[model samples]
Target chain A: MDRGTRITFLAMVALLVAAPYVLYPVFLMKVLCFALFACAFNLLVGYVGLLSFGHAAFFGSAGYVTAYTVKMWGLPPELGILLGAVTGAALGLVIGWLAIRRQGIYFAMITLALSQIVFFYAVQAPWTGGEDGIQSVPRGHLFGVVDLQRPLGMYYTVLALFLAGFLLVYRIIHSPFGQVLKAIRENEPRTVSLGYETDRYKLLAFVLSAMLAGVAGGTKSLVFQLASLTDVQWQMSGEVVLMTLVGGLGTIFGPVVGAAVIVTMQNYLAEFGSWVTIIQGFIFVVCVLTFRRGIVGEIMGRFGPKGAAPTGGGH
Target chain B: MFELLGIPPQALFGQLLIGLINGAFYAMLSLGLAVIFGLLNIINFTHGAQYMMGAFVAYLSLTHLGLAYWWALLLAPIAVGLFGILLERTMLHRLYKLDHLYGLLLTFGLALIVEGFFRNQYGSSGLPYSIPAELRGGYNLGFMFLPTYRAWVVVASVIVCFGTWFVIERTKLGAYLRAATENPTLVQAFGVNVPRMVTLTYGFGVALAAFAGVMAAPIYQVSPLMGANLIIVVFAVVVIGGMGSILGAIVTGFGLGVIEGLTKVFYPEASNTVIFVIMAIVLTIKPAGLFGRAT
Candidate 1:
């Protein structure tokens, strides 16, 4: 990573480490899980120019699988989360294969449709326990070493998971493969002319993104000891999109900040009930209409390394 | 009792009729969406919310103004259409030069605002819109019983769909519309009011959805949450139809509605998801859509 990026990231990490001491650790844990979720989403929209509207499928399903395994199969927490990540990868493989056939707006619609199919399955498939969901999921001991029953143990574990996912996304975005993905995003026809299999790159990026989303989802359920329809709902998918947009679509750490802002809003706005939807919708309109660069993206433009693109993929 | 394919004919035909009535709404809404997308190049993500508004207007007019159902049918579309025009002029028109996705995002937010506010006011529970006295009864054709209102819905929707098709495909005004959609600058040079047409096209498209909502008020509860639930399915119908052709949108919307109804008859659990399954298959085979002209 560049000096600018590294410094900013370490500073953010320090803030997160110190955050729980002052704020409720549970709420902070929720923010960290969603930050990881949005970062994975940014990996696709920011770099690859592919918008997958059904990401909640990966995030929610991984949560479900992890919750089911730990609570029902009696597996260790780490293994359950690993299995959740695998499920997300498998779902990505199938969804990406179909969704990549279309591009732009149609691509968004296809992902949304496929995710609805997943939502219906979650609603009907009895193993999910229907509307009640797999509740009271035991966080169990982390890797059979640290007892996660303590809020601090759970909080640090979530922070570690978020950092791992964030760093992995950073690594991928700077890799040669990420370069090819960006090339395709800028000019697909030229990328093809360069003899690159653009579709393969897209599919691989989609899989990686989905796996990370799954990791976040699985860890989230463990944190709350519950997995419900709320996670898999289309609104959750939209929430991720909003988080990504508010943070800055293409910049590193933009989605993390966006997720933090949104999660905190939900916590504060809980008493307003459905007013939250209106407020969120208002944010969507304002952001799309004017502030598409988002908070983090703007910060990067003014202070970070020069030559950063003014707007990231699919403004 | 006579059976068709081991299921009772009465149940099968009843479901099919329900499917056909649903198909009518799908046809009308998708047709409007097709028209808007063809000209504006942006999906009207708020189509559902506007539809719910149509129903809400009907209910509100009834409760507050003591306007009868017939009066609501006449007035709701105009009210909703005017609101749509206001939105088009102020907001949607701004995004014409940006990425089409921005338009989608903006409309989606507007929809959430509309639906959420209505839900807050009405508490998500449906308020009833009674069938007009003239259309309150049913007709039995020996094989199955049909509600008079439902039969009228099919007939009225068919008339509306055909009327719109004739106007767009055959009329002088439609000629101008077609030309404007193809080349607005040239149409403007020829002294045609292209911008007005664009705004009207958006309003008209939204009006079509509202009209369907008016028609649906009697059969379905006028609920805040109804449109959001229904519009996603309409989106699936639009995908299967493709945005390239007007007729394709009409035919596919009705076709899928019937197919969904049939799924209800055969595999009850899959009814909700059957259209989406078909959409996936169509995407794999013909990503542009079954009827849409390829770019």
Candidate 2:
């Protein structure tokens, strides 16, 4: 990593480690979970240039799976999370398989449509508890050892998970595979002419992104101790998009900052009811029209060397 | 008197009519989307919110302004269309040179603003819009009873949809539109004002959605949340039909609505999701959609 990025990363970690002592651990954990989710989403949109509007399917379905397995099946929290991630990857496989057949706007619409099916299923399925959702999920012991029921314990565990997911995303972006993904994003026809199976690469990136988003959702359900329809709603999908856009579309740290900003805003604006939606929508308009570089991207462009900034993933 | 597959004809026909009514809305909405996408190349994510606005305008005018349904039918589209023109001019026009996704995101944000504003003004609960006196009762056909309003919706939407299709497919204005879609610079060089055309096309599409919403206000609850879910279904219809053909969009919208209704009759559990399932099946077999050319 570059010197600036490394220092920024260390500072972020240090602040996160110390954050729970001052702020509510539950709220911080929520930010971390969303940060992870946004990072995963960035893998597709930022690097591969594939925008899947249906990411809530992976995130929420994973939440449901984690909730169900931990609460009903009596599985430990770790196992439940693993199962949730697996479910996410499985869903990504199916959704990505179908969605990659089309590109651009149609791809977004297809994913949205498919995810709506998941939303409907969640609504009707007997296990999801319909409107109430799978509630009162047990946090469960971490591998029969650590007591995650404690606030600090849960906070640290979530932080650890977030870091791991964050590093994995960083690694994926720098890898040869990631280069191919970027190449495809920049010019799919050229990448295909270079003998890369662009679809396979795109599909793999999608699955990985979905899997990480699942991890975030799974962790979130445990933190909240409930899995509800709110997680699976199309609005949830849009929220993540807003988070990613506001922070910075392609930057590694952008989604983290974005998630933190959005989550914090929601926390503060909880009392305002639908005004939050209006403000968020306003931000979306402003961002698309004027602030496409986003907070992190703009910062990087100003301070970093010429031509080195991500600048909203090359577009 | 007879039963088809052990189901009473009354029940079956009633559901079919309901499905057709739904299909009519779908046809109109998707037709609007297809038209907008064809020229603008941006999926109007705010299309749903615009639809909801149409219903709201219709409802509010009745209660607040004492404007009746007929006036709402006239004014709502004009009001919503003007709003769409404003959006296109101020916001959407700036994004024509960028990736189309920005347009989607911008519109999505606009949708949130509009939906949120309405939700703030009127709570999530639906406001009632009574059927007009001219179309309140039902027609007792030989096999079943069809609500007059519902029948009128089908007839109105069909006429509107075909009228749109005919104008686009056969008229001089449509020829210019088609040429512009293929090559805007060339069309512009041919002395046609293309930007004005784009703005009007967007306005017209938004107007069509409002028209559907107004038509739907009485039949369905004029709720803020109504268009949100319906828009997603229409998106599925768009995918299944593909954006290639205007007629395709109309047919797929209506066809899927009927199929959804059939699913409701046969398997009630799958009714809400039958269209999405069809989308999956269509993507598997024909990714370009039934009517879309492979891009």
Candidate 3:
């Protein structure tokens, strides 16, 4: 790794390691889960240039799956989280298969419509418990060893999962497949002429992104011990988009930063209720109009190499 | 008293009428979306919020100013259309050169702002919007009783939809719009004010949504969330019909509404999701949509 990236990584790890002692573990865990979710969302939107607006389907459904398995089927937390990730991948496969048929705005809309189907199912399905959701879910023991019920144990477990997901995303972005995805994003018609199946690349990126988002959602349910309609709502989908957009679309560290800022804001402004929506919308407007590079992107542009900063992947 | 497929005609026709009424709203909204998308090249994500605003405007006018339904029908669209024009001039016009996705994001943000403000002020519950005296009550058609307001909504929307189609397909002004959609630079080269046209088209499209909202005020609860829910369904309609042809939007909107209504009769549980299911099926078979040419 470059000296700058190495230093940033070390600093981030250090901060995270020390965070639980300084701040509330539960809140920190929430930020980490969302950070991972944003990173996963960034994988497709930033690298592949495909914005799947229905990502909440993967994230929320995974939460439901993990909650149900751990609570109802008496599975371990690790196994529950794995089931959640698998559910996300399966959903991603079905949704991605349909969404990849179109590009750009249509892709966003299709994913959104399909996700709404998932939302309705969650609302009506017997297992989901409808409006109340799967509440008071037991976090259960981690691999029959670690006591996840302990605050520190749970925090460390969540931290480990976040770091693993973050590294996985970093690896994907640097891989040969990631390069081809970027090539497709930069010029799909050219990529097609070069004989690469652009659709396949897009779909694969989508599934990976969804799987990771599921991981985040699953981890989040364990942290809170609840899987509610809020996670699956269209608003949650919009929240992740806001987080990714605010952090920086293409940069690896951007979504992490974005997620922290947004989750923190939500924590502080929890009592303001609907004003949060307005403020978030205001941020969205400002970001699209003036701050499209996002917080991390702007910082990187000032300090990092020229032309290294990722564009918004415009078509 | 006759039954079709073991169901009474009244039940089937009742659902069908409800579907047709819903189809009217869909046709109007999707038509607006198609028009704006054709010219502006951005999905107006705030279209739903604007529809909600239309309902609110009508409701507020009646409650505060003592104005009636007819006045709201006349004033709501104009007010909402002017707001839309202002939005286009100040904010939306800036994103024309960037990716279309930015436009969607901006509008989505705007939608949140608008919906949030209204929700903060009025809360999420339904606000009453009584039908006009002229349009109250129902017609006994032997088979099923049709509320006069409901029948009027369908007729009014049909007239407006056809009128928009006529203008776009047959008129001189529409020729310029069609030309602009094809090549804005060429249209500008021909000395037509394409930017003004773009702004006005957005306003007009938003106005169409408002018009639907005003028509919808009495039949449905004039609630802040009404548009938020309907817009997704309309998006699916846009996907199934493809935004290539104006008529396709109208046809698909009404057709899907009818189909959804039929689902309610045969299988009530699927009524909410049947449109999305159709969208999935359509994508698998014809990715470009029913009327859209593959781009």
Candidate 4:
């Protein structure tokens, strides 16, 4: 990472650690979960150039699985989360395999159509608890030692997972596989002619992205102690898209910043009621029309990639 | 008195009628989407919201201005289409050269804003739009009671769909539009104002949605949430129809609506999901969509 990106990431870690004390820990956890979710989504859209509009299928399904395992099966927290990730990977395998056959807009539509199917299943399926959703899920003991019932304990667990996922994304983006994925995004035909199996790379990235999203969803279920249709709805998928777009597509830490801004905005604007959606809509229009580079991207653009501005720059 | 596949004729015909009505809306909306996508290459996510807006505009005009249904029918679509034109000029025009997904996101946000504002102002509880006086009652046919309003909606949609198709496929104006879609720069070289053509095309597409919205206001409650859910179903229809040709969108829209209606009659549990299931099967069998040419 560049100097600016490094400092920014560290600062975020410090701020996230201290946030629960000053702010509501639950709210902090929610932001972290969403930030991670946006990052996972960005892995496909930003890096792979595949905009999957139905990501909520993975995110929501994982949430349900984790909730069910912890609440009904009484599984350990780690195992429940693991199951959630596996569930997401499995779903990603099916969806990504089918979606990769088409390019661009068709891929998006197919993912959306497939995700709707998942939503319908969740609605009718008994395990999801129908409209009520799975509720009162036990946070359980974190690794058999940490009492997750405590806010700080839960905060740390979520923080660790977020960092791990974030680092994994960073590593993947910089790796050779990541370069191939980027190549696919930039130009698929060229990548294929160069002997790269572009579809396989896209599929792998999609599955990995889904798995990470599942981690966020599963953790969210434990953190909020609930899983419902809200998590799996197209609205949630749209929110991730908004977060990623606002932060900057194809950037590593942009999603985290975007998530923070959006979550903060929603928190402050909670009293404003429905105006939040309107404001978000306005922001989207503005961003697409003018600020396509997003907050971090703009900062990086002006500073020549040095990450000079501590507050606005990448690092 | 006889049964076909153990289903009563009355029930089958009832579901079929309901299906046809749904198909009408689907055909109109998807037809609009296909047109916009063809020239603009942007999926109008706000199409649903615009449809909702059309209904609301009609409602507002009727309640506030003492306008009749006929007047609102003419005015609502024009009003919504004007907004669409303005949106294209101000916001959408900027993204014409960039990734199309940006347009989708921008429109999605717009949808949220429109829906949110409506929800806040009107609340989620849908208000009823009275059926027009001319099409108020149902005609008791031999097998089923056919409401005149519903019948009008289906017929009107079919007529509108065909009219659009004919305009695009037959007229000299349509030839220019098609040529523009294939190569806007080339069409511009031919002395046609392609950019202005694009703006007008978007307006026309959105107007179709507005027309459907006005039609739907009576059948479904005029509510903020109406378009959000309907758009997803329409998206499924668009996928099944393949977004290729105008006729395909119309046929798929109506066919899927009928299928959904049948599902409601036979297995209400699957009614809501049957369209999506069909989309999945289509993707598995012909990933390009039924009417869509392989890209």
Q: Candidate 4, residues A5-32: lDDT per residue as tens digits?
A: 7898899889988888899899899999
Tens-digit per-residue lDDT, B25-82, candidate 1: 8899889888998889888889999998998888999999999888888898999999
Model 2, residue B136: displacement in angstroms?
2.1
* Structural similarity to truth (TM-score) of each candidate: 0.98, 0.99, 0.99, 0.96
Compared with the true structure, what per-residue lDDT tens digits does model 2 show for residues A85-196? 9999999999999999999999999999999999999999999999999889989789898899899989999999999999999999999999999899899999999999
Residue clash pairs of candidate 1: none
Q: Which stretches of candidate 3 lie over 4 Å from their true place?
A: A313-315
Candidate 2 chain A worst ten-residue window by lDDT? A306-315
Indicate the TM-score of model 4.
0.96
Q: Rank the candidates by DockQ, best first.
A: 3, 2, 1, 4
What TM-score does each prediction get for chain A alone? Answer: 0.98, 0.99, 0.99, 0.95
lDDT scores of the candidates, listed in order: 0.90, 0.94, 0.94, 0.90
lDDT of 4 by residue, B205-245 (tens): 99999999999988899999898988888888888889888
Give me candidate 1's TM-score against the actual structure: 0.98
For candidate 2, the TM-score is 0.99
CA lDDT, candidate 1, residue A108: 79
Better of 1 and 2 by DockQ: 2
**What is candidate 2's local distance difference test score?**
0.94
* iRMS values for every prediction: 1.8, 1.4, 1.0, 4.6
The model with the greater DockQ, 2 or 3, is 3
Give DockQ per model, in order.
Answer: 0.66, 0.78, 0.81, 0.55
Candidate number 4, chain A TM-score: 0.95
